[model samples]
Structures are given as structure tokens and as C-alpha cells.
Target: MNDQNRLPDVPLRASICMATYNGAEFVEEQLASILAQLGPDDEIVIVDDASTDDTVARIRQLADPRIRLIEAAANQGYVRSFEQAVRASRGGAIFLADQDDVWIGGRLDAMLEALATQAVVASNFDVLGGGDRPPIPRLRAADSGRHRANLWGIMVGYRAYYGCGMAFRREVLPSFVPVPAYLHESHDLWLAILGNTAGSIRHLDDSTLLRRLHESNATPRGWRSLRVILAARVVLLRLMVEARRRLRAASART
Candidate 1:
């Protein structure tokens, strides 16, 4: 571990914010994979949402000084837990992590390189399932085609951004955090929408993560009910309106 006293008080280069809940089955593996990629200067900020399982114990077993654990008083859902973790991070660039995924080697380097040019970037990832499943499609940004002029439109329409493969610079934090209570989308998508409107969201071609598929995933599996679809549409409309407002404000400043 790097000596903290010798380091400056300013934010570090990379701060990974991971939210975990009852993920003892594979959390250790995920942590080991990520920790191996980080430098002595990098840090991982983990927020556990009151896991009843041995997840906390397993994480503590790592005993790495770079890892900081924050135990939530109560069980907040994934969105809120992630919000807290992000808030607690002290890095100029933030990476999101899921407790069950295995990060590919060089993931941090690739993301940091992208962040040099883009305010927010997401990379491709291979899917992993138990017992040898076929390869899954790579995660990519949607092709806007005629809607290329509107980045937010492409994001809202395709919903392709995955948080596990995403990272963003600290400059975008103001627009990304304190996630709107009314938005029905996940924190990743909301940040993507804002990044797109800011003209700094990008998709890297490299696959830097192994996204594990399992029953414990917080993402909905298949088709959703009509009620869910309608709610999502409403949220999308609201997001679009806000994006437009911000764009106008930015244009005026320019």
C-alpha cells in the first residue's frame, strides 16, 4: 500500500466506487481481479448495503489498505448505494463496479486513456455465465443514424449504457450526482444522458470487463409489463426536456 501521508491532499487519479449486497459468492474474486489492476495510488471505495451474508467478512479478508468499506445503516437499493459510494470517492476519475463481475486486465488503463479525451466513456464487455455459455453480444453505443444530431435521443432510445463498464471524469460529477428522484433510469444511464448532452460521452471498442449474468442481477431480465414501459417512457421524456434545457444554457454561455 502507498503511504497516505506522503500523498497530496488532492484527489487521486482513479477512484472505483463499488456497491455490494449479499454478494459473498463471488465478491472476493471480483475484488481480487480489480485490485490487481490498480496502482498503489489508486483506491477502491466500497459501499455495502447491509448485506446479511458474509460479503462484508469476505471483503475485509482482503485487508488491502487501498480498499475502504462503508457500511450503510440500512438497506438502500443499488441506485442509492452507488450514489453514496460515488459521493465518498476522492478521485478525479470514477469507475463503477459490480460485486459479481470480473474486470479484465488493463481495464483501468483503457478507461483512463479514454477519459483523457471524453468526459465519460463506456467499454465493451464479454458476458460470463456458469457452466460455459456461448459468447454474448458486445455492449456498444447505439447508432443514431438520422438522429446523430441528438445524442440524448440515441441514449434514451437504445438504453445501451452499462454502469459496470462505465467511467467518467470529475468535471461531470455535478450533473451526474444527486440523481434525480423522478428519473426511472439507473444512475449509469442518467449519467450517460448528461454526458451525451455535454458532448463528452463515448464508447471504447475494447472489451475491458467480464459481465457476469446471474439471477441476482438488479437489472430486469426480459420483457417488462406495460406499466413499467409507460413509466420508463415518462422518465425518458423528462430527461430529454432537462437535457435540452441544459444545452440551451450552455449555448448561451458560449
Candidate 2:
């Protein structure tokens, strides 16, 4: 999230927002891992991105009341699919999730604890079955409140802020929702931008989930061309400006 407020008196409801394409093979296991951790007040909001496979059917087969399934008429890609899930969510705490990952035990307790005071929380991850870790270095707890430093890290492409490892309070949604129109990818970094712009994000050192990498992943599996890298950097610069504007507008309203 580049998404929250700190009103402790209000009831706590966690919304796990997930986007799925053709994930029938692993969706059930992922959902089971997450559902086991959710309380009665919590929910799992999933948006299917027009999967031609049995993804939607697998979700419907669950028959869980805590699950809210939204079907897309056509393929809108994962970023907008996630945005739709977030906008449709009713929880005060929003957690971004990927369909192929398994939530580590106590993840909810750990992240919700961070969101209590910070607007956003980004945790670390381990590759499932002891596979190679992500190319970027993991976040350090010592750098939790260093928003400027974190922003620099994100811009330099070493912060490793994957959506599956991030969550935020509801108050910050206005800062990054309706994500930058040109962003056909890297939504996590966009959220990280707004989160750091507001100077309120917690970086957790511990791994909260086990990620499964596959060829069908929405994120590219190989290195991008230098031109693409430079283009993406320009987009990051634009997102930084947009984040500041949104944060200022939100502040004026308050």
C-alpha cells in the first residue's frame, strides 16, 4: 500500500487483497494458508483477471463466507486488478497478496502490529522450498523509519518492495490508489513511493511469506533492457511528484 490512519478505537478489519490470472494450481493452498490466519472480522478480497483456466471455478469452490470474489469481464492486468480489489475492500488494514505465495505463520499479527502506528509496512520474504532469494537485498528493521533513505533505495531498484510483502492502513489509500495511468507494471514500487513520501512506513526484517516464482509470473523473469530500465526510472520520478501532490491534497482536506 501507499495506503492509513491511526485511530485505535475503531474496530480492526484486515482485508487481504489478491489478484489472480491463471493460478488454479496454487490458489487453494495460498487461500487456505491465509484463511487460517484471518479472524471473524477479517476478509480476503480477490479479483480475478479474466483467467481462461479454472481459477474462478477454484475460488468459487471454496464456499468461504470471508472470501469476496470479483470477476473481471476482460483481462485488465494485475495492477488494476489489485486496485479494484483494494477499492472494493472494506477493511481498515489492507494487505496485498499474490496468488502463488504462502503466508508465513503469524504474518497478520506481525504486519497489523506495524500498521498500528505506521502508514505502511513492508516485510521480507523467502523463496518457497529454499529456492534462490530475490535478486535484491532484503529490508532491514534498522531502516524502518528512514523514509528518505527508503525512497532512495526504491529509486535505485534495490529496496525490493514486492506487493506480497507489503501492507498499509486505510488512511493512506488516497495517496496512491488509481495508480499512475502509465504504470503497466511495478505497482508495488508506486505504493512504496507514496508511503515514503508521507514519511510513515515500517520495514520489517523478518520474512512474512514464502514466494513461489514461475514462468507465468506477472513480473518479468529476466533482466530488462537498459532502455526499459531508464524509462522506468523516469516513471518513478513522475510517481514521486504525483505522490507529493496527493499527500499534500490529503493533508489540506484534513
Candidate 3:
């Protein structure tokens, strides 16, 4: 990483896109963690979803020129907020970030290295902030036994990718952005599905982020009952059908 105040001679290689909403409690720490790994050539683009708290203030306090903040006029959900950040970014590679999670050391370098060969890459992450009892069970593409097959199967079936641990090339943006209004999936999952279909999608066996589990997280974790799981599966199936339809339509246009 280069000095924050200095500019790089080369063009920016990576654009980190983050979406925030009332994330004042951990946004500062997350930003610091990300900043430590970024080079002078990299930039952070944040889209805040009309937060009523000090999330935007905390971000402004950083005062780093590399950090660009965009305040949304109305509170779009997380998916749309992320879409706005990605559209505003100016880098060959785009890394999705969550406002509350702390990134691990060497995350950017590792993901970029992986992205050189694959269209998209997702890394493993350790669950953080959960108490001594037990951490929540999050899926990883590597552990799901479906990476060799269509990677989207694992994503659509198991919901394996987390945005904070994922990165993709700018070329995939055409198919990813303006995320389909009918798909009821998170932005990360949508990207994973599209990236897998567009080119190669792989899982790096490194823990690239500390996934913090807290109450304020946009995607809550209490929906584990049998009926809830079934309903969720139905929703995922519908998303998969719609996603395939969109892919076909895109191919036809191309």
C-alpha cells in the first residue's frame, strides 16, 4: 500500500464499492481496515442509503481523497445502493464491500491475483463477533462441493458468496449492473450467478474478511425455521429461473 496523501503514477487498478445504512457503530473500523490494504492507485466509492445516524459523518471524518461518498436521496435497499456504488466506480477491477465487516490483510492483492485468471473470485472468511456459544453457519463455495460444476448452482442453492469477500473484473459490469428488478436476491449473489455464467468463477481458500454478525446487519439471521427455509428455497428457485431468462436475453442481444 502507498501513502494515503500521495498519488500513484499508474492508473487505478481496483475500485472498492461499499453500501452503507446506519452503520455508524462499525463503519470507521471497516474503512480503516480497507484503507490499510489499498494502494494509492485504488479508490473507495461508497453509496449511503439515507442513513439517519452518523454513518455518513464517520465516513466524512476519514477525509481521505481516495474515499468518494455518494448520498442517496431516498433509501433504496442494499442491492440498489451497491449497484449505485459500482456504477460510480472507475477501475478495471471492482470489489464489493459491506460497511460493518473488517477486511483481512492482503485481501486486495490476493483477490486481484485470482481475478487475473478468473472472471470472478470469492474468498473464505472467518465469522467474527459472535459469542462463545457458536457462530452462524455461512456457506462457502469451496466447501459446498459444487465449485467444479456450475458455480451458480452453489450460489443459487446454498447462497455461498458474501459481498465483502468477493471481487470481479470491470468487464462483468455490463451484465451485473442495473440489477434486474425482478430478482429477489442480494447483489452479491446476483453477481456471482452472472459472473459464473459469463466466465469462470472460483473460490480462493483464504479468509479474506472478518464477517461480523450483529443485529443491525441488513440481512438478519433468525429465519432458520423449517417453514422459513422452505419459503426461502422457493424464492431462490424463482430467482434462478429469472436469472437464466435474463442471461438468455442478454446472449440474444449480444
Identify the candidate with maximal lDDT. 2
**Using Cα atoms with residue i matched to residue i, what is each candidate's TM-score against the true structure?**
0.86, 0.94, 0.82
- Candidate 2 C-alpha lDDT tens digits along 16-128: 99999999999999999999999988888899999999998898888887788888899999999999999877789999999999999999999999999999999999988
Model number with the top TM-score = 2
Query: Which digits, one per residue and each the tens of the lDDT, describe model 1 over residues 19-53?
Result: 99999999999999999998877899898999999
What would the TM-score be for candidate 2 when compared with the true structure?
A: 0.94
Please write out the lDDT profile of model 3 over residues 76-164, one tens digit for every residue. 88888898889888788999999989899989999899889888888878777644312333555464235434544543345457777
RMSD of every candidate to native, in Å, equals: 3.8, 4.6, 4.5
Who is ahead in TM-score, 2 or 3? 2
Clashing pairs in 2: 3-172, 4-169, 4-171, 4-172
Summed over model 1, clashes come to 0
